[model samples]
Target: SRHAQFAKPHSLWLNDPDSEQDTDEDDSDEVEQIDQDEIFDLIRSISDPEHRSMTLEQLAVVSAPQITFNSKVPDRVTVEFTPTVPHCGMSTFIGLSIRVRLLRSLPERYKIDIRVKPGSHESEHALNKQLNDKERVAAALENPALLEVLEQCLSTAGRST
Candidate 1:
């Protein structure tokens, strides 16, 4: 049941050549911690708005190291993405894609934090604010043109609703 709930398998077991078999129930199984690779896979296939031929991964915008889940606080997930160019105009949309992907894939308890990687974009703070703004995100998603673009980007990732 735990395997079914997780994207990757959660348990592992190894036998020692000279040691007695461990029979402790505590050693029976351990769940793997959710990590950045899992987060990366969720958004790696999102297509860049400017370069429809390239996914964000190909453009080096989204990376695993930039994604972090707070160990002390299981409800938080922060993803920082870089644009192919510092002046790339689609940074906001890229952030939106990451946000949407996580929203669809992660549990409701997760508080997603989507931002532009520091020093990677010209207007990083403003763009981060826009991307993280609940009101702005809601308004942007309501616009048919914007939603269309998001759908186009996500469709390639096999996650568009």
Candidate 2:
């Protein structure tokens, strides 16, 4: 039931002949424009790291999705996720994957803020702070050399020791 709901298409305007005729062309055009919320929703469909086929929604990692954009402040998006267990080291990696998916899917203008949902073993505030540390994370994300290192590590792990 929940999976069906998440999988449903979010139309720009619900089809109602009467409503469509009542609105001006400009108004209808504005309504069709996709915003950050829509972008986030698309990114949220990305599957969890541990689970191959099932999406984050299916795995129930994602909670409430919020997006804010303002002229005075940088655009910020907050996503809440829960790990399979309290002590999962892969939680941070999963969070980073979600962040990368968001960044790649969204326009570069947005600044993402990802956090683990409260009531978990990990500190939500601390995780949030780590995710928000752009300077440190950006260096790793931007460096091709670092990605190569990560790929090597992954390849090595896949082989018998």
Best by lDDT: 1
Off by over 4 Å in 1: 1-33, 158-161
Residues 1-161, model 1: lDDT tens digits: 12122122211111112212222111112224557777687788788766767888888888889998788996698899887778776677778878876777666677899988889888888888888888877776675555666666676663321
Give the worst 10-residue stretch by lDDT in candidate 1. 10-19
TM-score of each: 0.75, 0.56
Cα error, residue 34 of model 2, in Å, equals 4.7
Which pairs clash in model 2?
Answer: none
Q: Assess each prediction's global lDDT (C-alpha) against the native.
A: 0.68, 0.49
Tens digits of per-residue lDDT, candidate 2, 60-79, equal 66644544444475456566
TM-score of 1: 0.75
Error of 1 at 85 (Å): 1.0
